[model samples]
Target: MTKALTPGSIAPPFARYSHAVEIPAGHRLVVCSGQLGIDSQGDVPPDVEGQTRLCFANIAAILAEAGMDLSDIVRINAFVTGREHLPGYMKTRDEFTGSPPPASTLMIVSGFARPEFVVEIEVIASAP
Candidate 1:
């Protein structure tokens, strides 16, 4: 099992996710590249919520390719183009992971590689 950490000395995380995660011994790590909302046909979603959903879909596909799933995720890094998208991002994220949630960092960035892209997500997971 992955251990989610919330150290007593620090302020609690502002949202879902732990301060850190301690992967158990003997588990290997899976680090995924940043995923955008572009689909298999190469279309990017126009809206942040749609893009966020697609990002998770892409992540799930990568995890499946590695023989793992969301439960194995120990950490995530999310980048959004704007602040308004955060609520949707959090809702979609909570739907995917986190009984306790994985450690995460969310950032508001100026933009993405493509003008249409609204969000990007990357993750680090544990595998037995």
Candidate 2:
């Protein structure tokens, strides 16, 4: 199992995430591509929270393919178009992340491949 690391010498995480994670040896790793909010029917949600949920759903599917689940994730990299979308993204993200929480970074980016997309998420997972 992975260990959440938050050294006492440093400040605590600002949000619901670990500062870092220690992945043990002999574990297989999976690095997923950044996933947009579009659904199977090619529909994109207009709201950030909706989009964030879809992002996690898409990530779950990818992890499933490798015999892993959301709980196996050790790090997360997320991007939103603007600051206004931060709360919505974080709320939805908390629902998907497991106990001990994954190391995470949320950034405000100018945009993505499409203008309609408000959020994007990518993750790294490890399992023995």
lDDT against the true structure, per candidate, is 0.90, 0.96
Which one is best on TM-score?
2
Model 2 C-alpha lDDT per residue in residues 17-119, reported as the tens digit of each score: 9999999999999999999999999999999999999999999999999999999999999999999999999999999999899999999999999999999
Best by lDDT: 2
TM-score of each: 0.95, 0.99
Question: Scored by Cα lDDT, where does model 2 land?
Answer: 0.96
Across residues 52-124, which tens digit of lDDT does each residue of candidate 1 receive? 8899899999999989988888999999988998998888888889567999999999998889998999999
Stretches of candidate 2 exceeding 4 Å from the true structure: none
Task: Give me candidate 2's TM-score against the actual structure.
Answer: 0.99
Q: Give the Å error, residue 115, model 1.
A: 0.7
Query: Which residue segments of model 1 deviate by more than 4 Å?
Result: none
RMSD of 2: 0.5
